[model samples]
Target: MKLLVCIKQVPDLESRFKANAEGVWYNEADLAFRMNEYDEYAVEQSVQLREKLGEGTELTVLSIGPDRVVEAIKKALAMGCDTAVHVQDAAASGKDPWQIASIIAAYAKDKSFDIIFTGMQSQDRGSAQVGVTVAELLGFACTTTIVGFEYDNGTITAKRELEGGIKGIVRMKSPALVTCQLGLNIPRYPTLPNIMKAKKKEIIAIPVADLLREESLAATTSFHPPAKKGGGIVLEGDMADLVDKVIAILKDKTAVLR
Candidate 1:
C-alpha cells in the first residue's frame, strides 16, 4: 500500500506579525518555523499506517512552498515517510486556499496511492479548505477531523467530529482522503538515528510552473495588523463605589441597560 500525506511549513503561531512597506506580510525574521501542528499529526498517522501495513508500504510526503520548506519535508521523512516531494516556487508564499488545493490535487492526480492524508488545516491560513477542495478535485471520498480510522478487508472506517455534540462514523473503500485532527494521535519526535537516516533519503524538488501553470488567484486587498490596544483602567474604591462604577461603565458600553 502507498500513502501520500501533505505537509506544510508555517510561521510560529505566537510570533508577532507585521506587514512590510510594500503591503506584504512579514514575521519576525529571526523567529523559527515549524511543521504545521496539525500536519505533524497527519504525518504521525501516516507513519503508523505504514508500520501496520508492513515494510512494503510506502509513505510519501508532499509540500508546495519556497525552498525554506525543505526543512518541513525533511522533518516528515525523519518521522518515517519514505520519500518527499517539494515544489519550489516563490509564488506559493501568496497562495490562497483554492490555488494551493489545485496545485496539490494536480500533482497528486498522477501519483498512484491507495490513500491521501492531510492535516485539518494549515496554521497560517486556518482556512480548512485544502483537504476538502483537493478531495473534490481528485474525485475521492473524504472525511475530515478524523479522530479514529481503521482499515480491514478492503474497507476503511473513520470517526469524524461534528458540531453541536455530534459524532459521525463513516465507512469507505480504498482511494480516499482523510484530514487528521490533533486528537488523532500525538506526533512522534524524530530520533537521532531517524534524523541521520532521513538525511540520506532522496527529496525531489519540482518547479511550481510544471505542477500548475498559473496562480488562478489574487489578493484583492493587502492585509494589515490591528492597531495596538490602549491601556486598561482598574477599579479602586469601596465596595459600593466599585459596584456603582462597574454598573455605569457597563451601561455606557452596552445597550442592554438602556
Candidate 2:
C-alpha cells in the first residue's frame, strides 16, 4: 500500500504573534511554527494503517511552504513516515486553498498513490477546502471530517463526523482522498531515537513553481483581529422576571409573536 499524507506548518498560537509591516502576513521571524494540529491526525492515521498493513507499505509525507516547513515534515518522519517531499516556494505565503490543492494534484497525479490524506482544514485559514479540491483535481473519491476508517477487501470505509452527533459513512476503492478530523486517532510523540533517525531521512525538495502551471495565487485584502465582545449580562431574579428579561432581550430576534 502506498499512502501520501499532506502536512502543514502553522503558527503556534500559544506564542505571541504580530503582523508583518505590510499587514498581509505574519512576522515569521518572531513566530514559532509547528505542524497543523489537524494534520497530525492525518499523519497518525497513515502511520497506524502502515502498522496494520505490514511490510512493503510506503508512506510519504508532503508539505508546501518555505524552508521552515521542513521541520513539520521531519516531525512526521519521526512518527514513522518513510520519507518526505517538500515543495519549496519563497512566494507561497498566502495562496488560497484551490491553488494549493492544484499544486499538490499536479505533482501527485503521476505518483499513483493508493490513498491521500490531509487535515480537514489548515489552522491559519481553516477554509476546509483543500482536501476535497485535491480529490477533485486528482479524480479520486473524497470524504471530509473523517473520524473512523477501516480497510478490507480492497475497499476503505470511512466514518465522517457530522454536526448534531451523527456520522456519515462512506466506502470507496483505492486511489482516494480523505480529510481527517480530530477524533480519527491519537498522534504519537516522536521518541528520542526516532527523532535522531528522522534527521537522516530523505526530504526531497521540489520547487513549487516547477509544479505550478500558472500563478493562480490569492491576494489578501486586509487583516484585522476579531472584534472584542462585551461582558455578558447576568439575570438574577425570579423565574417570571427572568422570563420577562429573556423575552425582552430576544424581542429584536423574534420573527413572529410567541
Best by lDDT: 2
Runs of candidate 2 with Cα error greater than 4 angstroms are: 229-258
**Worst-scoring 10-residue span by lDDT in model 1:** 19-28
Q: Can you write out model 2's per-residue Cα lDDT over 1-258, one digit (the tens) per residue? A: 889999999998776666777787677887889999999999999999888888988999999999989989999999999989999987666787878999999989988999999999988878899999999999999989999988885699999999998999999998899999997988999999999999999999999988888555567876667676868688897999999888987775686645
Cα displacement (Å) at residue 142, model 2: 0.4
TM-score of 2: 0.86
- Model 1 residue 228 CA deviation in Å: 6.7
Model-by-model lDDT, in order?
0.87, 0.89
- Per-residue lDDT of 168-204 in model 1, one digit per residue for the tens? 9999987899999878888999999999999999999
Residue 144 lDDT in candidate 1 = 94
- In Å, residue 191's CA in model 2 sits off its true spot by 1.1
Candidate 2's displacement at residue 90, Å, is 2.0
Q: Cα deviation of 81 in candidate 1 (Å)?
A: 0.2
Which lDDT value does model 2 have at 51? 81
Clashing pairs in 2: none
